[model samples]
Structure formats: structure tokens, C-alpha cells
Target: MAKKAAVLMLILFVASLLAGCWNRKELNELGIAVAAGVDMEEGGRYRLTVQVVDPGQVASQQGGNGGAPATLYTSEGDTIFEAARRITQISPRKIYFSHLRLFLIGESLAKRGIGQMLDLLSRDHEFRTDFYLVVTKGTTALGTLKIMTPLEPVPANKLFSSLETSEENWSPSLSVTLDELIDNLTSQGKHPVLTGLVITGDPQMGQTKKNIANIYTPTQLQYSGLAVFKKDKLIGWLDEKESRGYHQIHKGVKSSVVFIPCPEGGKVAVEYIRGKTNVKGKVVQGQPRIDIQVEIEGNIGAVGCKKLDITDTATIAKLEKEVEARIIDFVEETIDKAQTKYRVDIFGFGEVVRRADPKAWKAMKNNWDEEYFTHLPVAIRADFVIRRIGTISDSFLNQTKE
Candidate 1:
């Protein structure tokens, strides 16, 4: 009888413990934040801009009030956490960040350094590591977030989806999550890079409902060049070409289009179907060297040139050579810029060397970026093969072009 009573008591206790949800927040008392922006205020203060979804408006079928899907609230304090906490003074409900998609660091804040902001984000259990981090180009984080985007009613969602799609189809832009950024920042060899966001057109109209009402959005957000960083500080910017080169060198590019000048004038557009890049690092006679070999397979997307017979194997071979040269140029220019202009090792060659020869890395680790990396000898080789030339071998452009 006693044994039966103990078993019953244990069962009751276990059930009690399992049924309750500890520290549970009811949906009614939570304000779900989808995007957050940080900008440095003049007095060394921090401004936190949060974009919260308007659930009812977002669900509206008839485009609710010109599709104002998200609402922005700004607050200022001495620190990021303080600014975040101050947001509650204006916001009715307690801010929740599990749904956060984007984190924007303003140019001022990014240049000043993001290590402090990252500390708060890393320590706080509220902020997820998966959210992307972007630096606003030539504007505050708030300005970048204020502009309403077309198609995706919510500006935050637009930025998130646009970056994801852009990275796949475009080579210049890259998407970096908080975790990835932290890893790169913490790593000894590699520094971090983030896609820069720019607000185009008039800023005043971007915040209004009229921004999305018209077919032509007077104001829009664009993912521009990659923001190069020496540690957490923004050192400089890489143009679209340089950014593409970075992508190719680091194997960040999945697929993209390359336009090559044709032999007979005009340009030939090619779709990169498959690409492979191999970066090897080694110490030869006490000097470090890097070898980058790239192989690409692509198909003719468009031929804007006059009189090119892509059907001939010789023609395809010549086109392949042009493609290879272009890729090689991209790789070489990116390496040269990294060595001379930036003088930072964003390519992570140090890590490659470390893995290759630990003893050598230990000696060069301290002066890798400024000394060794700045004058690192690099060799690049690219090979390209022309796949199927679209639906038709040659463009009708050849038939009519004079």
C-alpha cells in the first residue's frame, strides 16, 4: 500500500512539473519585432529603431492603408540595451525579438566599431543569431528602414528577402548573419564583411503611405557594395566589381551572370551554371603564397554581338577563353585590392595557412594582416566551359546587326 502511494505521488509531482510553462509570455502582452536598427546619436547616445508588424493591416486583402505592414518606433539611450528597453515607453506591449529578421548598423556606428553592440546582442537571450546584419550606406539606420518597399509591404521583410535572392542571382551583394559576423570577427585570420544598404530617392516620401500607392516608388532601398571591415570597424567599401571578385575568391557566389565582350563587338551574356573555386595556402622557403584555381560551366544567356556562330566548337572554345580571362581578372584584382587598398585579410588565407602549417602560422599570426597579407604572393587560374547556348545557339541579334 505504501509503495503504491509513493508511485502515485511521484506521478502527480512529475505531471505537475511538466504541465506548467515557465516564464511564459502571453501573445497579448508581447510586441513582436521583426527588424531592429542601431544608429549613433551625436551625444554618444544610441538610437534603436524597431519595426513591428501590424498584424491586422498585414492580413488585409485590399492592401491595408496603402499596405503599411510594419510600424516603426524609435528610442534613444546611452547603450543599445538601454535604447532597447526605452522602446517600451513608447510601445504599448513588451517588445519580443524572436521573430527578428534584420539588424542594421548605421555608418557612424559601424565605423566607430560594432563589438560593443555585438556584445549586447550575444549576451541577450532575446536576440537570435540568425538575423542578418547590414550597414546603412551614407545614411542612418532609421532612414534605411523608413523607406517602404514594393511587393513586400513590410520594409524589413523586403530587405530580408531581397538579400537572400540577391546573393543567389547576384555576385556583388552578400548576406551575413549575426553568428557568421561574430565568427568572422572573432576569428584570427578572417575579418567580417556586410552588404551595405542605401536609401534611394527622396527620404520624406519614403515614410509616407504615398510611397507604395503609386506604381513608381519614389523611394526605395537597395543593397549596394560590400562594407569591408578591419576587425569590427568599417575600413572601406568594395565596389560591385570588387565585391563580385570577393564572392568568387571566397566561394560565396552560387550563380550569377557574367557579361563578356564579344570578338565582333557588343557583349555576350552568360549564365554561370556551376562554379568551383579552390584556395590553397602554403609556405614556400619561409614565404607564404596562395594559389586560387577556379572552374566554371556556363551557358549563353544572350548574345548581343553581330555574326557569332556558337554552334561551332571552335567558337565555343574561344568564348570559354574570354570567360576564363574575365574570371581570372576578377580574382586577381580582388587579391590586389585586398593586399594594397584594404590591407586586411578578408579572404581568410591565414586560416588556410594555419590549417596547412601550424608552425608557420604561429610565427606570422601577429603580423599577418599588415605585413604578410599586404604583400602576399597570389597565383590565380580560371577554366571555363560553355554549356548549352540557351534555347537557340546564336541570338537573332546576329541576323540584323550591321
Candidate 2:
């Protein structure tokens, strides 16, 4: 009977502790920051703009407060932390950063160098590292944030979701995160590249609700070229074709459409379904050489060529050859620009060399960015195969004349 009484007493004690706890903050008292923009001011001051969601309105089915779903608070200071804290003057509650979805660094700030700001971003326990990072192409980070976006209630969510989509479906747009960017900066082998966004149309209209009221929004955000960085400072940008080549070299493309012109007629669209890239780096008699081999598998999505017959195996072989040439062109063109214009090894060829032979990499490490990379010998070979030709082998357009 005494043992049974002790067991009963233990159960009661455990139940009491599980019933309650302390240190809970009400949701109403916290300002949830969905997006953050960092920009450099005229006198080198740091400007912070945070998009805080209006909880009640964001959750509502009906339009809330003239269709404004979030509120923007801005402040400037000598440091990021100081600017962040100063914004509380306009904010009703403490700014909570745990939900941050997108982080924007202005082109001006990027040109100056972003290594210092990245330190604070990583050090803060409240900030999540997975949020997408981008450099605003033509405007301040604040300008991008101020523009209203369609579909997504929160403008930040629109940018965030679109970047995710673009990374998966598009070749030119590179989706970078805080952690990945930091890894590139801290590592000696590779430089960093960030996706660039530009605000389109009238800037004044973008900040208003009418921007989202029409079928075609007056202002929209576009994911443009990749922002090339020499260490932490912005150096140049890779155009669409060059960006596609960069992705190909890194094996970063998931799915993309390629357009190849017909020999005698119109263009044929091919969908790149699967691909493999091999970057082999070695030192040959104290000289560095990189051999790149790429294998591509694709399917014909659309054929605008009236005379080309894809049904014959010989015709398919010719098309495959064309595809291979295009792939090689992309790879070589990007390498040429990198060697001549940027003179930066954004492709991480140095890292590959290090993995293959540490001694060679060490010898080339100090001058890899400018001297060695500019003169590095790269040989590229690409092979493409058409796995399928979609549902119809020949388009009905083949029956029509030009």
C-alpha cells in the first residue's frame, strides 16, 4: 500500500509541471518583419527598410486599408544594428525578424562592398539564413520594397516566391541565400554571384494601390542578369546568354528551353530535360588546364521549321549536332567574357583544381583571379541527344508553306 501511494504521488507531481510555463510574448505585441532592405545613404549612413505585415488585414478576405497589406518602416544610422533599432520609432511594436523572407542589397551598396553587412545578418540569431538575397539593379533596396506586387498580398512574398520559381525553371536567374553567399565570400576558391532585380514602369505608381488594381500592373519586378562580385564588391553583370552558360558550367540548371534556328527555315524549341557537366582541372608541366565535358538530353517542345523533318534518324542526328554546338558556344562565350572582362573566376575552377591537385592550386591560388585565370587553358566538348520528340514527330506547320 505504501508503494502504490508513492506511485500516485509521482504522477500528480509530473502533471502539475506539464500544466503551465513562463516567458510567452503575445502575437499582438510583436511586429513580424517579412522583408528587409539595406542601402547606403549619401554620407555613408546605412538605411533600413522593413516590411511588416498587418496581421488582421493580411488574413482578411476583403481589401484592407486601401488594399495595403503591409506597412513599411524606415530608419538610418551609422550601422545596420543602429538603423534597425531606430526604426522602432515608427513601428508600434518590437520588430521581429524570425519570419524574414527576402533580403535586398542596393546596387550602390553592392558596388561599395557588402561583406560588413553580411556579418551582422549572420550574427543575428533572429535572422534566418535561408531567405533569398538579391542585389537591386537600378534602384535602392527601398525602391524595390515600396512597389506593390500582384497575386501575393505581401510584396516581399511575391519576390521570394518568384525567385524560387525562376531558379528552378530559368537558366539565367541564380537563387542565392545568405548562407551560400557567405560560403562563397569566405572561401578562397570562388567568388559570389547574386540575382539582380529591377523595378519596371513608373516608380511613383508602384507605391500606390492602383498599381495592383489593373490587369496589367503599371509596375513589376523583373529578375535580370546575375550580379558578378569580385570578392565582396560588385564588379560586373552577366547577360542572359552568359548567365545560361554559367549555370551550364556549374550544373545548376534544372529545366530550361533552348531555341535553335533551322538550317533553311524557322526555329525549333528544345527542352533541356537532363544534363551532366564534368569539369576536370589539372596541371600539365606546371601549366593549368581545365577540360570540360557536358552531356545533354532534351526533347523537342515546339518546331517552327516548315521544311525540317524530325522523323528520320539522320535528321535527328543533325539536330543533335546543332544542339551540341549551341551548348559549346554558351560555355565558351561565357569563359571568354570571364577571362577578358571580369577577370574573376566566378565558376570555381580554382576549387576544382584544388580538389584534383592541391599543390597546383596552391601555386596558382595567389594570382588565380587575375593573372592565371586570364590565361588559363580551357577545352570544352558538349554532346547532346534527343531522347524524345514530344507527342508529334512532325508539326502541322510542316504542311504549310512560308
The superposed Cα distance between candidate 2 and the true structure at residue 267, in angstroms, equals 0.8
Candidate 2 segments exceeding 4 Å error: 1-23
Query: Taking the tens digit of each residue's C-alpha lDDT, what string does model 1 give over 1-402?
Result: 999999999999999999978999998888889999999988889999999998878889886676477888999999988998898889998999989999999999998899999999989998888889999999999888888788988888899999989888887888888889999998899999999999889999988878888889999899999999999999999888888999998864558988988766898888887888999999999889999888888889888887788898988898898888888888788878888898999999999989889999999999999989998989888888887888876667767746
In the range 47-75, model 2's lDDT, one tens digit per residue, is 99999998878888886565588989999
lDDT computed for candidate 2: 0.89
lDDT of each: 0.88, 0.89
Q: Which ten residues in a row have the lowest lDDT in candidate 2?
A: 17-26
Cα deviation of 371, candidate 1, in Å: 1.5
What is candidate 2's CA lDDT for residue 240? Answer: 88
Q: Model 1, poorest ten-residue lDDT window?
A: 393-402
